[model samples]
Target: MNNKRFVILASIAALGLSGCAGYREKRGFILDEQLSQAVQVGTDNKTSVERTLGRPTFTGQFNDNEWYYVSRSTSTFAFRTPRVIDQTVLRIRFDPAGNVTAVERTGKDKIASIDPYGRTTPTLGRRKSFFEEFFGNIGTVGSGGLPGGGGQ
Candidate 1:
């Protein structure tokens, strides 16, 4: 009985530990060290870059001169918010002639934290209470002697 109880307890502990193990996921572009290294600044052009690194995750907001390769690894334990464990952003800039001008790399250190001030946006209008808003439009949206109203 003692040996059976011990085995059962150990099994339970193993199950609990497995349940607590975090899940990791990779998001976005997959970076290949060898392929990335093959890109040469001032030597490779847009076609070569695309051949070496495939299509970019995104291009510059305003122009196509800049290409970005973004990758992130995130882990979540149970119900906790997913946290980034590793991130890489590769930026390739091209000259007007399409030759690679520069190659830059950024890591998780560049991640930005943003906090919104409030849930509601301030607008140019009078504030109305819940009851006022609920009843305010009730009587105004009827066909009652107005130009568009069917009643004459």
Candidate 2:
């Protein structure tokens, strides 16, 4: 009887401990401390940087002078939304000659948590009910309601 009790307790404990495990995910550039440190300003150009750190997560929106390497890790428990556990944004800026001019490293402190402004966005015009929105455009179309419709 005591052996049976002990077995049950051990099984329950094992199951409880397993429930605490969370799923972890890593995405984007996998930063290596040595490789990242190897890149030197004025010494490393686009080609060297690419050899050292691989392709950047993205380049500057307007130009190629700036490159960004981003690393992020997220963890999710059960069915909950994944939460960022770690993040790194390495920004390397190059001069017109393609030589690295600066290297900036940022951590999770740079991450932004944005909460949407509720389900619906406030619009400028007016609010209408479901029925109004459904039937509002019924008779408005094909009658020159549009500028170039030329409806008769």
Candidate 3:
């Protein structure tokens, strides 16, 4: 009986400790390292760009001619503040024939220079409350809880 109890307690302790394991994932955008060399003026084609840099993160709608390769790193500690560590954007422009015209790389340095105040006034729509977004409807029963609702 004592051995069985010890086994059960040990199992429970193991499970509890495992629950504290860190949760991490690759976050944000990251541009390919070869992008700088692969993309060049009047040399790269659509197929070549796709092959060299992989699929772009974003492509322009107005022109479908521009591609944006972006990469970002987000770190989070349990019960601690989460932050973005690095971000990079590679912009590739194509001509009417879908041939690469120019390639530009932007990084943290560009961001800092572009937004020194870190407060670019929005000229857009209204922003919703955090609780309303996370909990949906606070008054609704079985709805209000957390951002990702309970489910298996």
Candidate 4:
């Protein structure tokens, strides 16, 4: 009986530890090197561009000749609190002849054009809670004492 209990307990602990086994590395964008090699007009082809870099996130809606490579790195903790570290958008335009016509990079400095509104305005920060403002966190965690009782 003692050995059986020990084995069960060990198995449970091992299972718990296994859940945390996937160690994710700190991901970041290596954009500087890639951006330096500008897409020369009337030289780079679509196939060659894709081979050199990677698939573009977006293609121009009105025209099929334009390509946009949007690269961004976001980080979050236990909760999904996102923090954008780096963002780079490389816009490549192709001529009627299907060769690279223009290439421009839009980074932090040129982000204003991306969003006409620019940065989000800061609120007063005094946010009204769901419970306090509406119902409230009055009852305990597992308690079934609220208005709509036994649903969960």
Local distance difference test, per candidate? Answer: 0.92, 0.92, 0.75, 0.69
Order the numbered candidates by TM-score, best leading: 2, 1, 3, 4
User: Against the hidden reference, what TM-scores do the models get?
Assistant: 0.74, 0.81, 0.53, 0.48
Kindly give the stretch of ten consecutive residues in candidate 1 with the minimal lDDT sum: 139-148
Candidate 3 Cα misplacement greater than 4 A, ranges: 1-24, 28-30, 79-81, 109-152
Model 4, 84-152: lDDT tens per residue? Answer: 666777888888777888888886555443444557555686776666766665554456764566535
Query: How well is each residue in 13-71 modelled by candidate 2, as lDDT tens digits?
Result: 99988987889999999999999999999889999999889999999999889999999
User: Alpha carbon lDDT of residue 128, candidate 1?
Assistant: 94
lDDT of 4: 0.69
Question: Which TM-score value belongs to model 4?
Answer: 0.48
lDDT of 1 by residue, 45-68 (tens): 999999889999999999899999
Query: What are the runs in model 4 whose C-alpha is more than 4 Å off?
Result: 1-38, 109-152
Q: What's model 2's overall lDDT?
A: 0.92
* Tens digit per residue, CA lDDT, model 3, 1-152: 99999999999999987766555555545555765575778888999888887788889988799998877776666556556667778889998899988888777566543445556665587776887689876655544464555533
